[model samples]
Target: MNNTHLHLVVNHLPIIFPVVGIILLVIGIFTKTEVSKRNSYFIFILGALASIAAMATGEGAEEGVENLPGVAESLIETHEEAAELFAGLSYILGGISTVALFASFRNYIFSKIMPFTVVLFALATLFFAQKAGTTGGEIRHTEISSTGTSQIIGEDIKKESNHHDKE
Candidate 1:
């Protein structure tokens, strides 16, 4: 119903996109199907565009939920930091995929380089996805909080804060 919700909805597509693209890419390579390769490239390009939208909405989502209970500013900051990196890579990869698609269309020099670029993009995407997932997990899992594992959220933050004050 808000930017956060919109971001969540859009964000999922990018995460799954690379996996699907990679599978298709591999299949395309094995089967020598230029059509498959082109389609897979198109999927990656779409995913990259979706990544941009997700990134745009992410800031608004952060603003909306920054003060929520069980949420920490530091945690959000950490997530944002990783998100910036992830989004940047996704954009760059998407751009490369777009160019490759154009080249493939022309029967141009892209055939030689496109495969390597796709593999690189897939690896980069996989890394970004991992970082994003970890940061997201930290949002609700106190044990994985960026500040420290022991800094619990929810009722635990209150109990621990109070206990520390008494000491």
Candidate 2:
């Protein structure tokens, strides 16, 4: 498949994985379940790997779509910036998760606090993920764009009705 198709397929993983990880982490925290927390670390690592794929495909996808009708460069730039931040955070989270996993296994003193720390980092990553996702959506989905779809549709309807009245 083309880069755009590939990007579309893989891009959601980084976002979705962390969401699942966050939920698992919360449950782990509340129930004090080591298994749940460990699974969340694994999920975060997967998310970091997915972020690499997503970032790799993004440039090619941009080249494919940048000149398409109605696609805005500004939106692409915004999304790119946000995605960079998100990916960076994802990588850090993944590294920390790896360390946390190892520490948990060894019963390191820091292991006890790692889950809470990772939770904070994951939350920050999530914020950037939302920003990136929204900006990416705005690039193609005009309904969700900042321009406001109601105004666009209302103008179209007015023009159509006016033409009908004239005819």
Candidate 3:
């Protein structure tokens, strides 16, 4: 409905993609399957695109949430800082995925380098994802919230989750 809403929708992709990509990449490496490796690259590239979308939407989301009851500006600021790092990592990893994709398709000369690049990108993605996840959790989960400025949203999440479990 809104930028924030769309952002929430797309935000899950970054988390999902890198996880799936890592699994695929590992499987590919173990099995020595070019196809699996290529698929992993494609997923990572999509994840990068999703990260861009999430970042763009995040600005509006931040604005929307900053003034909400129980929301703390300080926590939002911290989240913003982590988000910047996440976006940068996504772009870098995405770039690597693109190069890897091209190399895979063309049977290019950089075949040797692609594996190493993928490994690097995968590691970077994992780090960024952790940072992003922690920051995002702080948005509404008070106990986990590190902004040190906002009321905890942990109860809210717990209540909501409990309610869902009942259903």
Candidate 3, 1-167: lDDT as tens digits: 98778888998798789889888988887888889989999988898898888888999998778877777777778778887888788878878888898898899988657866796678777887888878887777767744443334465777789999999
Q: Give the TM-score of candidate 2.
A: 0.88
Tell me each candidate's RMSD, in Å, in order.
3.1, 3.1, 7.6
* Candidate 1 residue lDDT tens string, 5-36: 89878877777887888888888888888888
C-alpha-based local distance difference test score of model 2: 0.92
lDDT of each: 0.80, 0.92, 0.81
Query: Whose TM-score is greatest here?
Result: 2
Record all residue pairs in model 2 with backbone atoms less than 3 Å apart, i.e. clashing: none
Q: Which parts of model 1 have CA positions greater than 4 angstroms off?
A: 143-149, 153-167
Residue 141 lDDT in candidate 2? 90
Sort the predicted structures by TM-score, highest score first.
2, 1, 3
Residue 115's lDDT within candidate 2 is 95
